[model samples]
Target: MAYPYDSLLPQVTRPRTISPLPPSAPGEEAKDEEVEQVKWKRPAVVTPQAVHSKRALLEKEQEQTASSEMPRPSQGELFPAREQEEQHRQQVEEPEENGQNIKAEPQAELPEAQSDIMALKRKNKDDMRRVQEENLNQQRGDQQNQVSERVAATPLMKHPLPSCLLTNKDHVQAELQDSEASNKVREKRLEEEIKIIRDKANRLSQSLQKQVAIKKINLQGLQRKQLTVNEIMIMKRNRSPSVVNYLDSYLLGEELWLVLEYMDGGALSDVISETFLSEEQMAAISRECLRGLDFLHSNHIIHRDVKSDNILLRTDGSVKLADFGLSTQLTPEQNRRCTLAGTPWWMAPEVVTGQPYGPKVDIWSFGIVGIEMVEREPPYCNQSPASAQRLIATVGTPKLRHPKLLSALLRDFLSCCLQKDEEERWSAMELLQHPFVTSAKPASILSQLINSVKKRKKN
Candidate 1:
């Protein structure tokens, strides 16, 4: 309903506003008073920084009041004083242009100097402490490594399998069993191969002719050589014996298996038993025995059982060595064996000591044979084998003391031959050239005896 648009503007109406309720209750009045007091007490115009500072100062003050002791400030506090007092203090404390404080530059530099010194001391101490700790750690590591190495080196008893390994035992066993079966197959194949080789060897041996050429030997003239007790007795009966010589030869394989030689005479031992072997006799026998030993040794053969029983004498009183069954060929520079394989009575000290001995052992036995030839019995004759062994181990070297004997030469030679140490024993060749055996008269006598024995056989 527009009436007079130009005459009147649109009527404007005032909006109603709601008003807050007035405080009237006594409790509410008290709360409003508290809130008003808090607002009045708070600072009116505070910045964020000043407010934060004020809060911190209040908290500090509260903490100081609550604590039993309060810490003092690092810097001293300045105080407001009367004008005359301030003037006097300033004059006394401040440095004058020509005062000692101004002149004492070195003293003023002391604090800085002390701080630098303390810093260096602290650095050095820290370095030393660090080095010490590193060394201690290194030592500890070394100890641990040593302990672990020892543990690894020590053999351990059998142990139960680990739990995880035990769980897979069936699989492991299957693998091992397969390997064992393969080894069995390989062994069977090797055995078959060996059998084939053995069969081939047997077949080849059978197919091939093994012919042994037998030389025609004169059997009709071969005398049935026999050694008889009567012959031996007759040979002993004659002190000035007939000369008998033996052709040096070896024969093998007979029914009785006898080593036959034309008997010239019995051993010099038998003669020595009945009659005393004079110095000439002893020297002659010694030279002959040494010659035999030298010849045997030069052939690398050791007549290990060198004794009166083994040394046969011709009727001409010349000796011939026999019985090479106990002999062995010694290699050059190789020590003899420890087979405990010689006549117990003739064994060297080294043999009794249960050690490997060389051909020097024969020399030691030869010394015993020499004693037997001179005395007609073993040195420790009456004792049992055990007792003899004990005596030998202790002191049983043959000692001779004949007035007519070559004391210096014979005694020293026998001593060397009977040495307990194998290294010290004389070689057979060395014994052959010794003065007692090699003297011109003794050598000539031995040569005459040997030639007579040979001539008698020839006749």
Candidate 2:
């Protein structure tokens, strides 16, 4: 029988890992779409000329969808029937327009097909990227073919950079622009610029070249050296997850393969689907995430990207925060990191604004994840990543609005996690003591959500 968690939890790479990163899933895992052996279809690249054509096709589809789709009875009127229709319309036609297969039959419940929705959406984005890459390759190919033709026909000009052409007291500015047309040592455009500069340099004399050269005494002394994470980073302490087991790592030519334990439980995002988590349920998940955040913060590591997707679960009610691609290992001297990393929807404000941030950024992300647990998606889930970042940076912390609907204590808890001032924001240590977290049931409470998913999958 097909299992629910089985489809969700991806198989992982178990190689002896060379880097200090945790055990990881293999990079080349084929997506769910390709698993069905469907022939990959390539659509014409989206270009400005085709904009009207694409728009008219979309409008025709929307008109047809509206007429055929009957509105289902609103489920308690909390969410509208139109919302479902819009989602359904998008799901059905989005892939077809973007060059992927439409989903089969509708399921009785969202849980049955929820996993595929994300997979298809992700696939659509990947297809667009592929189209762009192909266009880039074709452009580069054409440029390569014309390199010699351009070199013969076009006269050499001064370097494009203004610094190179300035009339300031620089002596090199007096010489004629270099006219070496055959040379292509730099980038295609840059090589042309360099040849122009070189032609000017040749006229100055061999004496100028002699003055510029600082001959090396010995080339034999230079040798390559070994590299390690510790050499580049000042890691205060190293931490590992109890669930994500590290196996082995070895070098395969240019790439290093790391083996990590496979998580059978998939992600917490999967748990959020098809089920509305209660306050108690949110507390349990939040507490576990906070515990992990605390561990990282204490060790002077910042898990810059903290979101539901990055959190992995196991069958035994254990949850581990995964995906350390954006994680930073700060030394004792470093107070904050200025890198604008992490998912835009869940990003802290300071991070979006390019402001230096400390461990508290993770706390902000943790808060957003808590909100995510309540509403299957994070805040601004509907917005594009660029728009989300713009809105978040301009607006102060996002308010849940309609707060009276949720409990007062829970509202206060959100308030604590989402403080605009990083200095004022409650640390994970402090949030652990809140009544919401304090009264939260043990990690065992999560098993209820997991088991329900499994049962539904089994059905």
Candidate 3:
């Protein structure tokens, strides 16, 4: 069958045929045919140049076959409708010049097929462009995800604090804590020291308050009274440790101010009322009272008002005789006083009976003070002054409420002081030597009792 493009192929010429030889022998004919076939199949002698030419021709043919088989652009891409029409016009015009009249056929299906192929090529180009772009975007997304994972895996790369700086900061914090603790300790110590100093200052103020006291007396009432003058003179003349010292006296208009040593423990009466004393403590007090009475009697002075109220005490337990307003001096010629000038309860029986008495009256009063210490009050304390004076004159001696409770030595000492006969009563000097008085503890021991009373009162 003839194709439409057959005219484009090269023309091949036919080879000449030889006439057959007449009537060859039947066997010889077969031999002659084989020889002819052999001669026809025999290879021709080939030179180097011919061999090279044949090799080059074979390579050329191979190249032509490859080019024909390879894919090519569609006819629509190679030639548009205008180019196809121009080619057709040239074929028609050149046909008579080539000495042959050839008719050109219109290819109706070629253009339609070329158009469909061109449409498919454009679609493929768009699809390939889209695929390339999508692949590139996917690769970029994968690279970004890998970078994020690396960053998350190693946190030290993001924010790092050096070990040296951290250690130094810890050291500084510890030092600050220690310094604050030390400062607190020092502040506490200073507060304690300040408290101690404040206590000492308070104690010194109290001590100063107890050093001196003033007594005010109206001068108009006692200006001409010899008793007041004698009392002041006697106080000034006495210089015993067991006696209160007189400082100075002042005359302010109608008032006379007598400055005297202040006893911080107040009066012995106050001490007995507030608390009970042991026998040893009472003995110590008796010794001090005896010392004062001895001093007074040795000086020829009679303390007619000797009683617990007239006895003063210091915080150190020193006892002294005070309030010498009822005291009088005795001469060798007149050694007795008949005047009734003492507390009824503590008055001597001879004085209350209107008999003459002397310094031994003070010894009798001291014995009553000893009873006051034990019983908290003297005998006949509930009676009136007149009734007590009557009792003292009628009764030979005042008896204790519970005399059996007293020790033998204490009872003997009281007996010596309370003897009805003035000659039988022991003097203050003789009483000082009594076992009850001699066994007395030191005066310093009484400070404990004084301080306890003060603390209890404060509470």
**Steric overlap count per candidate:** 1, 11, 0
lDDT of 1 at 443: 34
Off by over 4 Å in 1: 1-254, 332-335, 396-406, 440-459
Distance from true position, residue 241, model 1, in Å?
Answer: 20
Residues 100-206 of candidate 1: C-alpha lDDT, one tens digit per residue: 23321222222332355555656655666666788799999999999999999887955788988877997899999999999899779766755664454445435
Maximum-TM-score candidate: 3
Q: Residues 376-401, candidate 2: write the lDDT tens digits.
A: 67778889999999988888688774
**How many Å off is the CA of 353 in candidate 3?**
1.2
Q: C-alpha displacement of 425 in model 2, angstroms?
A: 0.4
Write candidate 3's Cα lDDT for 1-459 as tens digits: 233322432332212265767897889986665444323322222234534665588679767877889866545468788667643333222122254433434333334433555556566556666667887899999999999999889777576569998899999999999999998997797667556644554554476565576677665665335666888999999878898877666554455567778788778888798899988889999999999999999999998999988888888777889988788989989988899888889988999888988999998888899889999999998899999989888886888879899899888988999887889999999999999999988998888887777666667
Write down the lDDT that model 3 would get. Answer: 0.77
TM-score of each prediction: 0.41, 0.48, 0.53
